[model samples]
Target chain A: MSKPAIAIDMGGTRIKIGIVKDNVILVSASIDADSGNGLRNRLPDIEKIVKDLMNGQKLTPEDIAGLGIASPGIIDTNEKKILSIDKKFGDAPEIDMEEWCQQAFGLSFCIENDARAALLGEWKYGKAKNYDNAVLMTLGTGVGSAAVMEGHLLRGKHFTAGILGGHFIINYKGETCNCGNKGCVETEASTWKLPSIAKEYSSFSDTKIAHVSPIDYELIFKLAGEGDFAAMEIRDQSLQAWAACAINLIHAYDPEILVLTGGIMASSSYIIPYIRQQVENHAWTPWGKVKIEEAEFPASAALYGMAYLVNSVG
Target chain B: MSKPAIAIDMGGTRIKIGIVKDNVILVSASIDADSGNGLRNRLPDIEKIVKDLMNGQKLTPEDIAGLGIASPGIIDTNEKKILSIDKKFGDAPEIDMEEWCQQAFGLSFCIENDARAALLGEWKYGKAKNYDNAVLMTLGTGVGSAAVMEGHLLRGKHFTAGILGGHFIINYKGETCNCGNKGCVETEASTWKLPSIAKEYSSFSDTKIAHVSPIDYELIFKLAGEGDFAAMEIRDQSLQAWAACAINLIHAYDPEILVLTGGIMASSSYIIPYIRQQVENHAWTPWGKVKIEEAEFPASAALYGMAYLVNSVG
Candidate 1:
């Protein structure tokens, strides 16, 4: 019986904190995140939540093996530093996460990019268990990606390799991405771009979904299912953008299995078959078909992943 | 001191053969390749050329350390076999190259994708010498690419990693590529697709280039220099596509140096600055600027590359 580990999965809208052991989440909780305000102010709340979760589970800080965080930005695992800032966590680069964890819980610490952490979780305990070459794409607030090649995680010289899938330019003349690239997949298909993309339809104002505030993929899928013209068009374009992104990933990394995760996958019933068909028609894999599967633990994969990392290091 | 090794670089239209030692080409020759007829029939001609070159240098078969080939298509170096067929080398997969080399010269033989060969050449003796992470893009009849990440060649599960730069889709709604992907950089910019892409312009028939047979990038650059409208449009589109491909490569494999090779780079005076500006404006590299340089040996890098591989393994 190994000691339980504390894991934090930071997202743009919410922060999920969990206590996990042996591939299971013993306890978990989430709080709304005001990402624009930055992560520094949220440390106290995270600490409190972790303590309360541990207490409810009848445990103490001493019972934990280590602490791990899956943050949404470019991370340097060896140096335990955030290399780049995402829109969600603007002040993340300045915070010394290792030191904070040390002073707070007195536990050993490890950190990785949230997408890469999720991949590690899947690679260790989920759908990617048997494959040596795998790619994970998290379709959420922003599209995040991570790849494993020949059983080794592909972290390049700057620690940015295999994590820029959403940033790939799929439409040269399309919209500009926040990352400065033009026509990136994220600029066309992600949640942040959904409203703008939907408004581009001339009939958008006449549609049933037009008045909805904070429109999401789920709503679009529902309206499209109900046969609304604007919704159907938006849904089709988004699907193609995702399919193009998938083909690009397949060509870029040559992974044996591509695992799709994140919130958008809640509509995998419609997304999977469509993307798989497009891949079948377009992807140029001569060796064999790349297996496309949904991640087993879409929401908690990052928690499991961070726990795995912390446990291994501890 | 190492013995001179034989190198063969196979292209769609021509074959470049050379004897190399200490990074110098002792003797070299070229022969037009009727690739449609397959590599099996070309073996006799290649053998004769090798013998003649060696005789002129006063060297016997035993004087050579080994033989290496840089051929177009996906190659499995471990099996010393061609795994996929390219339009250039349609019958390459069926040819037992190692066995043929053994029967012909009683020398150890190795083969690699030509783009990877060129990259190795650049990495060992050319512009990429000091950088541990580097990417090489070869723009010719087709755009080809290979990458070195963290001081290792990125050969993925199917031996196709880092070699699909041209196949990346930059215009998802654009023309279908020979590789079956839609709107690939190659479909928009490569020499093989040049005629079709040019014809898509309404004024193509009225331009000075209308009468030219088998139009190439050089003529387009020359005409564009003279302010020909159709030529200028074609040139600009090609440059942008190449720039997008460059950014894709940088984002995909975080390289310190990007070496641009191939015949199209003959106009590096125009291509380099334009691409540098676009990369500066669009690439998301926060760490620093990625240096872009022309290949030191655009025509003969693969010759040097194969020689290095053969000598090292010999």
Candidate 2:
């Protein structure tokens, strides 16, 4: 007899909105996002989307118990504020999420970093069920990650401990990231860096992917499967970075299960086995092997977790 | 009044024994450690030494509530046993420390890794007195470290999270460590690795200390202070490695204070300032500056922590 909650996963290209109850999504929909204009300028658009979602569902502000929003950035959920900005967020921190939720839906609201909320979702209902210690890494444009250790999200002395796993320096002098670090794993393998990394392959001069405007991991895997030498080389290199990042995560977080989410995992067939081999060979876990798996419910996951979060808080 | 605890810090070179009551060391003493042979062969010697210390004070086993030991290696404190042998402990896990205490003093025992015990001691009574989150690192023969994040010790999913900060790879292809990792901070800055690292320094052929028996951070710092070109180069490089590791630790464990302890910090006069500078300059903490300090008691810190372990567990 607890009240239902509205879960929102706000992303760059699209925002996923869902009404969840008892860990199930009752109604869900995706709306186009006006992200290129920057998160700072998209306030009215985002407000409209949330209001429309609630109106379309025929739910009044009093009907829902609370609202949960997952956004891309450094979020100190305690403050309910977006802390940092990156490629995905052009206008953030300025967007008063709490006020918007109060004015539009007349509900109490909670917000957390997208990766962290996804981890919460997985821990409550998805691949991480029954796991007290785990990490979920979303390998998309940038390597997004969060960790749960000893039955709690690993928010550290300043709530930044577990979320910065992607900024881990895998190569000391490899590549530059806008985070002011050099040779971070994300700077070498993530979708944001994939095009430049692909260009370094010997076959980049002749591959079919060269024709694509925004080349990515998907195209690399597909082209490699078609026997493109350069594509295979870069693909293997990217796999190494991801696998190394996984090993680093295993070392740092000591989580039992590392769940891979995000768009790049759509090519799970190629990435999974390759990364698994590297982990077995390189990771320094003396106790036993860490379980590596893929996420199942993904974009709707934070919504599902929202259902349980409100109850737990109460 | 709280019951008094007997704390012992066991090292390859020395043993420090202290009687602690409510976080204050009432009395303490030290004796040469048995390191010419394996540590397993020296337990009886260790026990006899502790007995002598107590006898000098005219105290009996019945007066002590429990014994706490800080040894150098992996520890299974819950079971009151050492788990493995590192450089100092050739055969430690084979020894039954808890049984030894029971037979000799008719008392229970608690044991922990030296690095972890030091952090615990600091958290409870030393520099990190009021801080609930902290990471303490000892830059001795190899970098030894432990972390407390958000008021909890990060034992991780594998019981290796905070204790293995030295093994964190700063450069995946940088250098090799005995733990099977490459470019770890320890492999670059620790005393045990300094000889080989110094050899590659340009001044190695001409430095005054190169003619000495063992080339270590001690000689490097000494010579660097005296204007040896090669020694200064090696010293600065190693400092940079350690500084990077500190920033990495800040991001990984998210501790409010980072404590530098152990042998290399014998010249903390130089290492402390540089680390604080680098952290302030490079570390991505928007909250504020991460405080850096030297271990207050240094050599006797783990012994102080041993008392804490005994009291908390026994």
Candidate 3:
């Protein structure tokens, strides 16, 4: 009664392909993106992986409804194309996804920004299913966000409405962001920028954080738990930045629920309560307090979202 | 034939009331709000002003569709009630406006936040009429904003969505806002806080600005024109704050046009160009440039908006 769909969640380091039906992934496969080769060069590998997954699941093109892709960068959902390519997939915009879908599987296709697709996935089958108005913020190398206002995905004039939450300036005089803005939340506390932010502290050389190679939130949280002063300070500052970002997003989109996702959420025991407390104290929601919660799916959210999207469109 | 509607724009200092029909104000009247006397105490005066204006215009309740009041607080448009009271009108939330309207005259009534009403007025008859997605920022004592996205007013779950644009934190480590946030646009650039902001500067005592009894944007702009360094510095900072505010709004609401209004626009020559340049350089709008324009009607926009609202809901 339900048709299977080919779902792909394309990220910076890995490509996840799956055959999904009835909100379940029948068979999934993944490969190193080797993004240095560019998305254009990886087409053949992606085709092979999808075919192998379908064959392993005993599925054919006729058994599938369509294909859905969740990708980084600005996605033109109507065109089923990636409009703007970020560092991970420099050649993504040049790829004809619809043509590829047609040739590889004789299937129609749909696409959405990875963050938006994740939010959609959450809304359809995850934590945000109960909320009509919700926002999803994924904290990792960069902050990625999506807003669903009154149950509709906020795709603005340029299709960048809900996805650019990371770029909202939390501190106008703070630091320069890659997006050509100063003091963006991502620039202030994201994984890629955290090292520099931590290094700029007053006594960085004396702190244990200064000696740690490949700096990340996990190491910082661990050091902070061990009563390292500098680590504690940076952790608090990062939390404050994230809290400010959540408040900013809350003010911007006016969502009833905020879904916190991505790698940083692995520290949910410390992160969730801190952000919730900060937002509860600061955000001006007269009607009621916004519910802050961890995302239901951590890794395969966008994959499920892609399947959901394909099914919805089909 | 169009029916007349009694429209009111209630503010801290003045109450603007008008008899409007077909988007035009037929006869208008005003009275001091005497806000110290409380909104409940001034209800009779408001009723008298409305009655006198209607009588002078040779109109009666039978000839009018309904009454529309735009007030400076969280307004429950559904119940025609003011839900939240600010400092200026402490008694607003307690007053049953629907009951008062029924007692004053046998007429239906509706209400909306003043800024939202102004935006609607602009959307219906002023500069923003050409664009479906637009944002309006009124900068003076405080920064007020309203957004129309895809031709619909953004009233969030709490009725605070578009109205809280001023409270969006531009600097997380900047200043403590009354709304419990740090470095809100209002906290940085509003008229009420400008003097304190100026006083915090290094050379404030030596500058010509220190001699000015009441430091305001008008005096600051004039002194900046006359080449006063302190005034120029403060003015530049203010413009930066405002520019950051505009970009924040642009990122948040995704508008096609940003309408600058309020008393501070008196320095439009310097203010507009500075903000436009900053936003053009910093904002990440990939579709095209958001048209920055001045509001067509500053004083009577809310009155017209109230009339439009009354007519639509009558």
Candidate 4:
């Protein structure tokens, strides 16, 4: 059994705060993120939410072991500091998270990249358990990943190892990515890029998919199921791009199991079979087949990861 | 001072054997490979060459610590046996290398992938020295690679981790790779794929490049330098593909240094600058720039790596 810890999963649009123990989130709350304004403005709200959640559980800071944060972007996990932030949490690099934790709760705390944190959670307590070599592919707004080789997380000098799967160039002649690379998996198939990808298809203007407000994977899958040509084309292309990304991860990390998570995994029924077949036919693993599985705690894996990190690291 | 060690680098066309000490090849020999007949038939020849090479050095098997082999395939280094082989070395998986080494020389031995051996050689004593996080991209018949993360080789469960950089899907919509994946860096720009890629160009037949027998990068670069339009186009695409692969490596491994080697590196004068600029402009390394450098021991890095492994490990 592990002591309770407060976990913060800071995302682009929402900040999920929870009180976690062992492998479960006991109580949780979510707050809207004004990410464009920066993380500095949200510090007070996060602190208050954490306090209220603990109070509702009849707990105090003294009852908790520590706090852990799962934030987007590169992080110096050893230093417990945000190294660089992307579109979300713009001011995270400037804020001293450790100092804030010390002032707010007088507790020890740690931080890790959200993707890595989610992987840690899954690897430690979810689908990837018992496997020394594993990879986590979290598909949502963008593809996120982490690799564990021989039971060790691959954190390179800059702590960016194995976390940039979305940015890998999967199409040299394709569109430019926000990362300034050409034809990234994210650029070709991510939710944020789907509308544009669909619009570029010649038949898109003649289809119902083009008229949908904020086109997403669910709508695409639905329309594709109904035999809409443009939707099916976009959906099939996206699936291939994602399958390619999966194979890339399989080759790059050489993992025995690849754990898939994130919001997009809600449609795992349609995605898993396609990806598994592609990997079976394509990956060059001679040892045996790579097991592909869904994450057990998709929505809260990062929180459990924070709990595991906060409790285990010190 | 280190004791002498025997090292063997097995390739498709040639087998290089060497007696090494103190990071240098004291004596060496090479033999043509009848790979189609399998590695078993070549074993007696390898034993004879190694013994003769030692005799020339006035040394015996008793004077060496151990022997190490750098073979092209997935290897079980712990077991000192090949796990799986590619186009070359067909019967490797069936051969008992450890038993052969014991019977031939009565010495202990280890085996590793050829690309990883080169990286270990570079990381331990060559250009990648002092960098705990490094990557080696050896561009030859195919783009071979190996990665060192935090001073540990990234050999995953299948012993295939980090050595498949060429197989990474850099173009999801591109040509199919021999490995069955589509748009691999190798499929897009490797030496084996260069002729087909060049012939696909609309103006290939009109250019002098189309007249060359067994077309390779050297001729492509030379013709491009002479302002041949088709050559220039092929050269540029290959450069971009290689560059994309470089960025993919930097992102995947998060290395501080990337050491480029292999036969293709003879044109590093032209290849280096192009890859460096692409990595600088596109890699999402917020920590700083990843230093791209040439391999220190281009032709014999694997031999030195075997020496290091044999000498360092108990």
Candidate 5:
């Protein structure tokens, strides 16, 4: 039997830590990240929390094989540095995370981008175990994606190749992308950017959505289900954007299956069929239709992926 | 030294034939394809032309190793059938192209999709030489592309893989693609669909482009270069579309190089730089910018690819 491992999922706000030998979680803990203070400044705080959690569970370093950290932004798996993080992780790129963990715990540590980690998780512990060619897309604040091609994570010559799925363009002239390009898919349809997009509609002031102080996809879907015209229009538009992004990935990567997840996936009952039908009608796959569906495990996918990736590395 | 081979590039309008070895065309011939009459009806005419060309040059079956046919549409290279063909070929998928050649001239035969052939051309003998990970995109009546990963064409389980680059969705609802989907890159940008797109632009009637009976990128670029406002707008928009498409390919297939070819490449002087700048500034390649450039030999890349492929099969 394989030994258990420590899995850590670090987000901007909080971190999820757990012990796992297989699919079953032995024990877990959550701690505030306080990411705004910079990684170096918060390193001691994180160490303390992790130490307390391990002691409370009566587990020692010898109990685990290694530690896996799933962080956001671009990861240089070669050097084990975060490298060019988003606004969220100030010292991520500069911080020696793997080395710090090694010195602190006298054990091995590894790092990976969260989306790829999630895909690894799904492939090992969730719905995509049988698929060798697949893509996992997280439609949360921004569209995030990772691809597996011919049983590889498709890291390519540079680690940047398979993970830029959200940056795929849905409209050539739709809206500007955060990466500074105009008309990227993420610009027109994402939770963080959707409210601004909704306001761009001519009837924003007259629409029911204008009355909501803080708008989101959930409210939009609910209002649209109740026949709010503006809400319905935006909802359809967002769906189309997501569907197009999916088809683009299918055409470009030729994946056998596509996994949709993230906070937006909670409403996947409405999103899945719509995307499947659109791809069936529009995507030019002469061989067969790309299978479309929801992700099996959400928050735990990346955590579990860490375990799979670490084991694979060995 | 490698033996010489004959390469034929079959198009709806014309056929380009040549004796090429190691990527250089020693001699060439061109004649109308006349494929509109249907394959069964046009076989004799095409056969005679090919025979006359080879015979006139004193080239014999003993002198040539094999003949590779770069046909338009889905080709099952292994099964040796067209697989999926359009109206131009009429019963092409059912035709025994290989058997016919064997009986007609005692020559070994093979076939590949024209786009994939072009990629093979660039990879083996043209600009993409020595680059194992790359993509060849031909922007013509419809966009066509093929990819090579770790030094091989990505022929998916069904042969549909790595050949649907043009069908990528650029708009979720921006335009209707002829494939029955809303907002495909082909619907919004390909030459076959551009005339109507320009007509719907609202300003077409007032712009100089309206006066041109056949509106195309050539006219658009020509007039735009001459300071025509409407043509300029359409040209910039198309450039942006192509740029977004480039990013889409880069993200989808983690290629180190992207080769742009086809008739539209006549505008590469402008297109390459625009895409390069856009990719440099906008794309999220954490490794570095995905190198973008024009197809080295344009229409000839496919023929070169054909020669190399045949030589390898032998």
Candidate 6:
């Protein structure tokens, strides 16, 4: 039997940690990242969670093969350190993650960008297992993406190639993005930007959505289902933005399959068919239609991917 | 000394044939592609041009190592055949290019997309020679692009990945492209679309561009220099479109250098500075700025690339 590995997925708002073996999570736990407190201050919580999970599983440090971490932002996998944390954990890049793992767990550790880890998880244990060329679009606080081309993960000179699909300019003359680009898909339609985008709609004052605070895709979808014009307009525009993003990924990476993930996919019944129609009508794929599917592992994709990475490196 | 190779660049309107050795062209010839006449009918002319170029160089079939052909379409290089012609050459996909070369010149043959060939040419013998990760954007009748990543030419599953950079949608709610996408960079500002785009400009009737027939970039730039308001508006729009394309390429390919080519670059004094500014201000390159430079070979990049391809394969 293969030994179990400890996996950690560090997101902007939460940290998910698990003990995984043979693609199965034995025990998992989630804690608020409390990122405003910085990652260094949260390191002790992560350690305690990992230890609790191992103890619950009746396993010790020697019983585990290694530790794997997936975090947002540019990661230097070779050094097992975060290179730049956009806004999530400001002090993450300065934290010596590999040294922390060695001293706390007494095991080897590997770290990769969260999006790339999600792609690896999908490739290894999900819908993309059958595909040699595939792309993943994760719609959450921001739009994150990763690609596998001809069976090799596309890591460019700076390890930023496939990870920036969210940043592709879908609207050349539109709003400016925090990434400094104008009219990125993330800027036009993402969870973090959804509230402001909703407020700016021309029909906002006359519709039910105006009364809703903490505007998100869930509320928009619910309101649109009730025939709210402003909500419907915002929903349709968001779908178009995502569909445009899908076509852009198809053109940029030439993938055989596009796997959609993240919190927004809860409405896949409406989102999937709409995006499918748009891509089929707009993408210039000469070979055949690229398969569009919802991602299988939603919450634990990075954890599963971390397990794969740790095992492969070990 | 290396044996000479016959190189052919098949464009929509013309065919350029040359005898090349050691990255240098010995002799060359050109003929109207007369694509409306069909590619099958022009195969004989292509053969004759190759023969004449070989003769002018005092070389025979035995002096050549092989033949390489570059065409503007999706190409199956393994089969040495064009896969899709996209209106440029209606009958090209059905023609047996390998059989023609074998019977007419007694040489082994290879074919690649024109844009990919140009990228290879630039990588082998131009400004990108020193960089392993580079992208080439050729701004002409249409925007054509190709990429090299980690020292390998990126040919995705369907051989369309790197070649479709021009087709990336920069405007989600913009015009529909002939390729089925809406608001592609090619649709927004390529040479073929310039007239229609200029005609729709708000200031068209009030400026000199309205009186110009067969509107091309040269006329627009000349009039813009003379302070034609419509011409200046159109020029700035076109520049923004091209600049957006540069940023899109940077986000997609993650290259160290961006090599610009094609006929529209004749106004590089205006274009280079504008695009460089946009890229520097907007591109999210955490490592460093991606260098933007003009292609070294303009008219004969594909021919030089063909020579390199033939020599490498031989």
Best candidate, lDDT-wise? 1
Clash count in backbone of candidate 4 = 1
* Per-residue accuracy of model 4 over B1-314 as CA lDDT, tens digit each: 67889999997788999998857888899999888889999999999998888788888778998999999878888877898777787888988888899899998898999999999999888999999899999898888899998888888888988899999998888778887778899998988888898889998879998788889999999999999999899889899999989999999999999999988898999999999998999899988899999999998999989988888773
Give per-residue CA lDDT, model 2, range B56-133, as digits (tens): 777787777688888776676666667654657667777787788888888888888888889988888789888988
Error of 6 at B194 (Å): 0.2
What DockQ does predicted model 4 obtain?
Answer: 0.83
Which of the numbered candidates is closest to the native, going by highest DockQ?
Answer: 6
Model 2 DockQ reads 0.55
Please give, for residues A154-226, the per-residue lDDT of candidate 1 as tens digits.
Answer: 7788888888989999998888898889999999899999988888888888998789988999999999999
Model 3 pairs whose backbones collide: none
**Model 5 CA lDDT for position A76:** 81
The positional error of residue A234 in candidate 3, measured at the CA in angstroms, is 1.6
Scored against the true structure, residue B56 in model 4 reaches a CA lDDT of: 86
Arranged by lDDT with the best first, the candidates are 1, 4, 6, 3, 5, 2
Q: Model 3 over residues A1-314: C-alpha lDDT tens digits?
A: 55888989887778888888756888888989898789888889989988888888778888898999998878888877788766788888888989988898889899999999899888988999978899999998789999999878888766878888888888877777888888888888989898998888898899999888999999989999999998899899889888988998898888989999988887899999999998999887867899999999888789888888888898
Regarding TM-score, does 3 or 5 come out ahead?
3
Which digits, one per residue and each the tens of the lDDT, describe model 2 over residues A1-314?
76777887888678887778867776777767676777656556656766776788887767777888888877777878887757566667777878877776677878877888888889988899899889888888788888998888777766687887778777654666867766677887898888888777676668787788789788888888999888888888788788877877777788889898888998998787877776777667766778888887766777776666755663
* Candidate 2, position B17, lDDT: 80
Candidates arranged by DockQ, highest first: 6, 4, 1, 3, 5, 2
TM-scores, all models, native as reference: 0.97, 0.92, 0.97, 0.97, 0.93, 0.98
What's the distance in Å from true for residue B269, model 3? 1.5
DockQ of each: 0.82, 0.55, 0.69, 0.83, 0.61, 0.85
C-alpha local distance difference test of each model: 0.90, 0.78, 0.86, 0.89, 0.79, 0.88
lDDT of 6 by residue, A1-314 (tens): 56789999998888999999857999899999898888999999899989988888889888998999999887878777787667779999898988999999899999999989999989989989979999999988899999999998877888788888889999998998878889999999999999889879887788888887888899989999998888888899999999999999999999999999988888889998998999899998878899999998988888888998888898
Candidate 5, B1-314: lDDT as tens digits: 56667777878778787777768886777777777776666566656766776787788888886777888877888987887665666678778888887887787787888988999988887788899899878887777888888887887655766777677777666766666667666776778887987888787788888888778788888999999887887788787777777777777777889999988778878888998998787777767767787888897988888888788886
* lDDT score of residue B294 within candidate 5: 84
